[model samples]
Target: MSTDNTSLHLEKVVPEAEDFLPILGTDFVELYVGNAKQAAYYYQHAWGFQPVAYAGLETGKKDSVSYVLQQGKIRVVLTSPLEKDGEINAHINKHGDGVKFVALWVDDARKSYEETTKRGAKSYVEPYELEDENGKAVISGIHTYGETIHLFVERGEYEGPFLPGYRVYDTKAKSPDTGLKFIDHMVGNVGWNEMNKWVEFYGKVMGFAQLVSFDDKDISTDYTALMSKVMSNGNGRIKFPINEPAEGKKKSQIEEYIDFYNGAGVQHIALATDNIIETVTQLRDRGVEFLYVPETYYDDLLDRVGEIDEDLEPLKELGVLVDRDDEGYLLQIFTKPVLDRPTMFFEIIQRKGAQSFGKGNFKALFEAIEREQDLRGTLN
Candidate 1:
């Protein structure tokens, strides 16, 4: 655990890069699951996401069904195959309910596709228009690290529940809103030496700039270690931190995720909140399990991160970790794997003024993750 700097904050000097494929923001994230209905219910009841739309057999889609849920600006589309065999079914069978598409809201889908494909991206879906009574929306896609895709959605004229095929879906069941404001960042885990490969892809293919990076020396525990690099788009609305396993005495979390997911894929989604204490409390009460942090970690919290606004007891009780950067501080906590395979999970974050990810908290955070891996019998 190296805490050399008195402040222990990682200062960023991100170089500005010219973005060819201009993205407005994240459109939505779609996950291929075994059961869309049950997954939607779990998200609604457990995570306080409100149902927004639906598309299925009754809506004239026979092969698959989808349910869209939203909380703040974050929209999650859960899709399941209705038939016995298809691409969606194949994805569910292989990845076990993980992120399939990370859609970006763009101004022009065709140009976005053209730019990326010309820059060496493999085309998954060509630009196509989907129109209904509402209007028209254009969508295109390109392959990324693993089975995951970056879907470009140009929905400037379309106005419906979600895309053109979905209709307003309401169950009449009240699910209170958790304070999740928007997606802070989404992290992807790659294989043993593939981090730089994808990092270069983002930089060269997508025109994203490197914000910050970490080696094993900055993010290692006694048992395990990993390396990460944060890449952000031109406007900074989108950020992706790519991670890969590093050599250590035992298997690291990145290695564990790759083993379980069977390839490189999204490891976690970090949702931002204005008040982490309140948001985490609601999540815990609603049956979301967070990683446990020992009480001793909070004894010197004030000294490590400097003064924060929230009460120390509440943060310690909730097992939320605090860290500071050159700009400011942030409060964050990691939930245990939301799935059975221990491949994907969620991170609740509240940025006070910090633009940097919690670099100061990496050691303690990875140690907590190692504890979980030990219980799962994967910490070799």
Candidate 2:
């Protein structure tokens, strides 16, 4: 994975500011599931994530179990409650298997909590410490859209497999590395007309700024339409694109997600990769399904995106889409829904010095999504 471009690309887009809080990067994305063990295996075998740590009945007294998976700079915690009628089980019942927390790494957890709460953010967890043999780390959290939370993690002096509670979970399973690097951006699908409210909430509560905006007019097809606005922190380490359904000839994809998800929540996560061609090839061979476009898209792709380093045949054969801006170009492709509910999915992206989102590919991408939703009977 290309880890060298993060600092350079973020510097070009964001100017230094005397903001109240400074976030380092994403610590992890936590998912609440009905079965953490099987879910962990699914990620490792399907997405090439390595098993890192685990917390369950074997570790100690427990009401829930958690499994940590890592690859490159990405870490995901899959948690499941052992008891019925608990909060974790309640969340799983309502939303199915989906993201519950988008944890952010910070330097000072207490200060970050105070700063955000003072600015009217709802508190999810007070600043607390968890100590181990290595050291101590502080953490706090605040509520976000749906039941999801944004946890502020300060690893202070602590150094262990994960937190103080988790132990190393070793396994004999082996999967080839797929070259997925880190989280590029997270997209949230809110209800109708709720996008602007959350965008303003991030601006006022977390001191983020607007990076880009897309309305229904620019990103729409004949069957469905949606509006999105991208928000980023000052250092540009984290980006969240909020989307809402716009009136169309039929139900938009955002509406379908909301109907199935039961509320506003994370729609998809875009993971950055250095070599998407190789990464996707491995993922496809390993049973990961991706959305496909008509061959006609590649016929005029070069004319639209101009010359790219990769040839047209490989990209078209693999069903990858290309887009460009003044800064540079990018190649991106989306996977089909990973869960049974058609709720959460993923995107494999390779950015070739491009600082902006792939705006040019939205029409084709949304049309593919509409096709899927139609088959699922979500679009009427």
Candidate 3:
């Protein structure tokens, strides 16, 4: 399904959902880059994504080419400049190829635009209609962190692979999916002292509520620390956690990302999976390098998270971390940076019954990040 012209085929995750923004889940994540063709290849080869849709000069788009790839319920749009000196090229120059658009699917783009802009969102793209033979799609957008945007997409009756002017990607090659279901949550890293401003932005402008919050005291290692607050929309279908660095003995992981990324931007996307071991196994075999904790982290795993369904040996072997709250347990692992900059990675998450965002694993996870930073010589 597309956040552009996508019709999500899955049932609502939240039943009897509270209807604030009335989101239909993530339609797609669009990234602006240097080479969309190569970016598409990397996602296909490394992450088991199949090419689903495409648009470019062949389709009368004179400025950019976009490749839409999908796996399970997840979709990603990779776009690059068809000509130099455009906004896409300038974006790549400033951010070094990261997420640009975190699109949301709505029933009425015009109303979505009016609702947020009236609530004080900086307007990016005015609500407009794009039409082709299949049907019409309405879309609008507003600015967010860095150069990122939230596109309100209304597909209405459109029923093609994606948006107008894009044809279904025809190919002989396809990679097996790694049990990834959908985007669980996307995390954003903000500049120093800037977390609450954006947090309030979502709460005030988009009607999102703060779900859970973590302070540096709750999420720090000896070397670094960060604070995060999870913000969820009315229906709980969309979640964004904003993070800012706290003073630490060394350059914390968030600071390193900010430094190398040159500004605040998306840090990671946590993808929900039906089977973490199987998904991670496939990703590992296919060349996904994950952050690893010491074998000793598993020594006290049972005592910490109580009993989990997964066998301990496999959990330890894969370097997957486990956490449990009153609700249930969750298995998750983090991939190393997916971009040249030390930004933009993926989190493979399998939530058994836990709605919590792996708070128990933060220490081990951040420590592992510091270890990686030490190797990169970026740690202060």
Candidate 4:
């Protein structure tokens, strides 16, 4: 089995001071959905996120509504407008309620915009400063695949809860912290022949490098297949894995996402937490349903991956999966389809020390998914 040699060697790490600016962390993840209210509830109740702020007709914003949810340092915004025909609707129709904005927090939005656009990025939104009574903030955006965008947020000068007109809501009920620290990685699904196109787009346009690559041969089950390549910035703070569907016996997950989402767009956002057990448990008790691996798989967990740092009992009870590499071990779990179209989902990950994605667990994960497909009667 070929392992990620780059992940194993600490000394070979790519320096971050090159073409990229220092990223504080993920500022917010904005999803464009059909209905922001329902989406907000799904995230707040099912994902253990607490309501933070809101914007809608009540706020005099007629075209759209947005709800902000917060858990730990993570803030997610669900946006849906009243209009039925436009870019937002087209995006939701094509992507089946996926991520539209990956807002990155930086020290200076104008500088970040200038640096990236000068390097060849397509400008989505020019740098503009928004302010209220508290302070001011500068935000800019650059285009990514399909209708997706990377928003540069300079919040050093702002002090309001989220943005202008968003007053902090004091809710008596707070969701339990799931140990999630920040956004780990986000994955995108592109067209049939567009994987390398985006890899190069990130490489040449955004100063990202290929962290890992998997051909259809590497990530295929008996019924489905796809190609994937992971791209990361110099600091490895932001990772995006782009995938494209390959010919298969049945409709691949990538194809399903494209079919319902209307085109190539984000497939999932993988959030990293410090503790998998606590995070997943809180999420489940809050109302999240997860994709289940068979109970029999746990019967041979020790034999397959060897003894892990975590006890097998709790892991089996929680249905979390573990894998190890030369660098270190990692624990991860996936949430079931969070959207009606099976297009959007999330992953809660705890990287004990490992940097590599769980290649060894692909077969097991896909098998579990195929079982779901069988039940849904969507398997081709």
Q: Clashes in model 3: which pairs? A: 2-6, 3-27
Off by over 4 Å in 2: 1-12, 16-18
Give the winner by lDDT: 1
Model 2: lowest-lDDT 10 consecutive positions: 1-10
Q: Candidate 1: which stretches are off by over 4 Å?
A: 1-15
**Every candidate's lDDT:** 0.91, 0.88, 0.88, 0.80
TM-score of 4: 0.90
Write out the backbone clash pairs for model 1: none
What candidate 4 gets wrong by more than 4 Å, as runs, is: 1-13, 16-18
Better of 2 and 3 by TM-score: 2
Judged by lDDT against the true structure, how good is candidate 1?
0.91
lDDT of 1 by residue, 21-140 (tens): 777778899999999999999999999999899999989999999999999989999999999988998888888999999999888999999999999999999999999998898999
Where does the lowest 10-residue lDDT sum fall in candidate 1? 1-10
lDDT of 2 by residue, 1-380 (tens): 11121222234235533345787789899999988989999899989998888889998947999999989889999999988798998898889999999999888889999999999999999999998786687999999999989999888566678888888887998686799889999999999889999998888889888888999898899888899999988888889999999999998878888988899999999999999899999999989999988899898888998899997888888899999999899999999999999889999999998987888999889888888988998888
**Per-residue lDDT for 1-380 in model 4, tens only?**
01111212123254532445555557789988888887776776667777888888887778888888887777899899787688888776666677899998777789888888997889999999888896887899999887789998877766677877666655675555566667789999999999998998888776778888988788889999889999887667778999999899998888877877778788888988887888888888877888897778789888877767787888888888887778887888888788788787888899988898887777777777777777877777
